[model samples]
Target: MIWLLDLDNTLVGRDDAFALWAADAVARAGGSGDDLAAIVAADGGGFARKTDVARVIADRLGWEADLPAVVERFRAGILAHVRAYPGVPALLDGLRAEGDRVVVVTNGTSAQQRGKIARCALAPHVDAVVVSEEEGAAKPDPRLLEVALGRVGADGADRRDVWMVGDALHADVAAGRAAGVRTGWVSHGRDAGDGPAPDVVGRTVHDVVAAVRALAAPAGPAPARP
Candidate 1:
């Protein structure tokens, strides 16, 4: 089995980091500056992809420094505030123990994703980390997910063995499903009103891991092949 994960609020709680950065950046942005509502709307209710948020905020603020640098500062702060959702490592380790492949497919600046992962000690468990800055595409697009699946050699015939778990309905669930990966939505108490959604719903990483464990069980029912 191969598992693809979405970082940010799925595995790493980033609401505080976003609130802090958005508050500062929007204030600096001036005219209409940064409307938290607008940014949140653009995120499609998921955690904002760091580069997307910074670029829009910078464009709105009219900042002159290199855009990457601007994004890096925001990401640095995100890393500082990163607290892994409980049971994340246990989940990852369990998958690995079952001889499953694990990959993290995130859409964000290279510096942003890696910075947070490095700080969070996520590297030891993840087999590959494919970030949009390097993959040349973002989530919900199927491009990065394809890359990760190809690298892991997860065939369409093995669709039941592939899973994409994340908190965002648009990016994680939609994208992962598009890429032929089974989807798991990690609901963090935020209601996702009516929308196209995930294959399974869970309250935390442990819940997600439980679902994964059940799916990967030798005698468990397999998801229809994609």
Candidate 2:
């Protein structure tokens, strides 16, 4: 199977890392805990535009730093704390070991996403990596997913043998649907709610790993060729 996974909030704890960064940034700016909470809330689980989030944080904390400086600080803070969720590395390694092609498809700047993959030690386990900025296409656009498929030499592979898994319903699931592949959504405990419904759902990536493996498993003995 060809597995296309999202980087942020899927394989790694991007929102959690941002929360940690927000807390520290708020405190350093002499803001209250409430201020920190507001900043995190404004992040909208990383769905919000980063620049918008930065503006909200700056306003809440009364930071005199310019927007670029604030965004740069966030970039640094995230790098310091971003890490793969427990068992993520093993999951990718296990998938690859079973002859599955695993690719990380993400919507972000090339440097930012690549840094997260490197920081989390995920580079070695993935068969290919596609960043939207580098590809000139982002999620919900079939091109990015196609680019990912081509990167791992799976462009001609059957869509039924491919799966796109991630936390975002609109981005990952929609992209998968657009690309004519199956989708597994990591809901992270949220309701599906008006987005493209997924073929499979899990609260986290670990929850879906078993299902993916089961589906990808070889049929029993090929029925002894009758």
lDDT: which candidate is best?
2
Worst 10 residues of 1 by lDDT: 39-48
Q: With candidate 2 superimposed using the best TM-score fit, by how many Å does residue 82's alpha carbon deviate from the native?
A: 0.5
Clashes of each: 0, 0
User: Compared to the true structure, candidate 2 yields what TM-score?
Assistant: 0.93
> Per-residue lDDT tens digits of candidate 1, residues 1-226?
7778888887777765655666666776664633765654554433556467666656666776476786666666667777767777777887789788889888777877788888778889878888988978888898888888877776553776688888888778888878776888888766778754777788886787687677656885878999
Largest TM-score belongs to which candidate?
2
Determine the C-alpha RMSD for candidate 1 after optimal superposition of all C-alphas. Answer: 6.5
> Tens digits of per-residue lDDT for model 2 on 1-226?
8899999999999998999998888878899888888888878887788788889888988876487787888888998999999999998999899899999999999888999999999999999999999989999998999999999888899999899999999999999999999999999899998999998899999887777767767787545554
TM-score of each predicted structure versus truth: 0.74, 0.93
Per-residue error for 198 in candidate 2, Å, reads 0.4
- The segments of candidate 1 whose C-alpha lies over 4 angstroms from its true place after superposition are 20-72, 155-157, 215-226
